[model samples]
Target chain A: MATAALTLYELAAADAALRFSPHCWKTRMALAHKGLEAERVPWRFTEKAAIAFSGQGMVPVLVHDGETVTDSWAIALHLEQRFPDRPSLFGGNGAMPLARFVNGWADTVLSPAIARIIVADVHGRVHAADRDYFRTSREQRFGQALEDVVADRPANLAAFRRALQPLRRALAGDAFIAGPAPAYADYCVFGMLMWARCISDVELLEPDDPVSAWRDRLLDAFGGLARSAPTARG
Target chain B: MATAALTLYELAAADAALRFSPHCWKTRMALAHKGLEAERVPWRFTEKAAIAFSGQGMVPVLVHDGETVTDSWAIALHLEQRFPDRPSLFGGNGAMPLARFVNGWADTVLSPAIARIIVADVHGRVHAADRDYFRTSREQRFGQALEDVVADRPANLAAFRRALQPLRRALAGDAFIAGPAPAYADYCVFGMLMWARCISDVELLEPDDPVSAWRDRLLDAFGGLARSAPTARG
Candidate 1:
């Protein structure tokens, strides 16, 4: 697969280089897993027209040789099928579906929990053109103002940490969710943490948490791909 | 390979035929998945001495040709390794660790949620000798009387159902948690529901829930092994 023709539209902050969407991070890790490279174009929340060709108002849109694929899960599948010779993303067997469960858990449970704690921080970092769009849509979804959603962040943070028990227990027995090697399953949950890491200064995991250890491993994976990214705290 | 020498100690109710421990059910499904049969020995909570030979007090102790294996996860691993030619519990690849995550979720999240609603029922159904032991241990764990924990059962039931979003979302895209076919991962979560099914009359799932559909499929798996069991409702 030629890297020159692959282009990915990633969600970017006002600074552009601080890409932080959890869904997009899943795709980024997957691309790195497959040893594939793409020219990443910074996209903002209000810039729906930029990704209109994909027929969806979402970033992490992968355009490969003129074929557009949207949704992080679909893009992962696309890359896996189109580049089978690269390292297997799901590690073959029946892991793909299990990875899908991890993906679903991350979306329905992990990301939502993290969002409650960092949604306000997210609003502050989006491109200025996207701020109102981000706040209105998120406020409607959350049924409150962004600041109010994070008002009880101490409690919300505790709940978010409690919600990670399954992931913590899973990591206690293995290096990654997918086993010894960090695969798509690891990327799925890691993407959620990366979202928090990039946009918020609030500590989501304890310094000694197994999840923190697992996240550290993934942050250092693929030549420190996630670790080297700029954070709001810095 | 020899089914005759395999004996499994499963948690039994007042009536020995009504076996309902969730962890034990995970092992039972794994056994059936491998086409291996074991002599089901009825065990009760108070009968720690019975399983003491395994150096632990838990049921789901598989004594295979005098080699004792304790814990459901270890037993599943034992079955997969010992009976590799029959069928796989995990569908090979890297699914074992992912299944471990599912197992952790079931134990830490799903079972505890279901237990709050069914502990009183479980207390009522245990063998007469085990009732006091069950009540004392559970009440301490819950920090209340068995009846108190389930007093607001209607609310508890709703929370239990809500906690199943990850499983529900996973099943929406596929027939089972492990994809098209039921595997150990499905059994891990299904075991928790079976615990509720056997010992409680409360409808933990709505009839239209995808989780209900998945449960029905597993209930009918292995020649109606689970469906044939007597429930407290009956």
Candidate 2:
């Protein structure tokens, strides 16, 4: 039986080629890790109807062989279970829960810290249809205008870097967060930084930082899949 | 040839039975998880000469068959390497690097946050000979007296609890950070909480928090090894 082609709805910028959502990047990297190819569908934030079939309003909505997976973490799990013979995403069963902790840290701590530094830039790069929705939702979340939220980018950037001490220390002895190789844990964090990289010009990491070196390695991973993506800065 | 008994130098309080150092608790839990018995030697902070042979000024210095291991992380790695046949501290090779991230998070983020709330309490519980040294070192670190460091206890306590959000989220779906069973990752964070529990009367975790429940499970782990420890509150 022929397998149906996997389709991924990714959060795209005004130029659909610029896919920058951190969560979607996680799925993108996971697919590349698993050696799976998917048909990329550029999605705007306000295009809820586009992914309504997934029973959720999220950009990382993956349609795999007629099965719909909404969350990025779930998509990675689906890919892992579906393609057990491929390179492992979590490395082992033990790492799945541990990766979840990394996922949680990225979601609650790292991404939020990056968001404060890049949300305003994000607003400028999003699709015209997504601009109002993104600005409105973010303004409500930050309780200020998008520009105002990033008005103190210097302090926000410092706090963001400080929040990365754990990641920095973790990478001090290893090439990647998952060990010597890039895996879901590294993807979980790299996706966030990718979000900033794709949408903003602000330098988030110093070149001398261990995290920057790790990010460079990841950018060169899977034949430079993430590096090839179009960035707003470009 | 008979194997020599393992000896662990653990940081002790005014009453030697009240072992309160967070790092020591990590080694303690790792030892129990590995099902290895070690003779606990009570070490006070002022007595740096006591562990001079190890070339370190810290407790949790594990002396195994004449091989001395300093630092909680090093001891854990030593135990894992020395007893590969036993229950794994890291569930698999993939988990070691991932667990290091957890260790780093506990060390840099969680422990420091907890110390702000409990430093004064910790100062009160150290051995009389160690009190002056402890207060002086901590004051120098905080740039203020111990009492003044924790003067904003309510705010510090709230911040500490907020810092546990990642842990709380991680434990929400699994019983332990290493998945269904407790491993080095769980021990790393649990050791920090145990530090607060043993030294401070300040209530760190709320009753209904998932983290509190996870802590309950660890307290009951290894036939209630941690729960059996004497807290300064009593």
Per-residue lDDT value at A175 in model 2: 93
- For model 1, fnat equals 0.76
Question: Each candidate's lDDT (Cα)?
Answer: 0.91, 0.91
Using TM-score as the measure, which candidate wins? 1
Error of 1 at B146 (Å): 1.6
Candidate 2 lDDT, tens digit per residue, A1-234? 345489999999998888999999999999999888899999898888988898889879898878888899888899889888889999889888999999999999998899999998988888888888998899999899888889998899999999999998998878999998989999999999999989888889988999999999999998999888899879
Candidate 2 local lDDT, B150-226, one digit each (tens): 99988998999989989988988789888889999999999999998898888898899998889999999999999
Calculate candidate 2's fnat.
0.80
| Candidate 2: segments with Cα more than 4 A from true spot | A1-4, B1-4
Model 1 steric clash pairs: none
* Candidate 1 lDDT, A123-188, residue by residue in tens: 988899999999999999999989899999889989999999999889888899999989999999
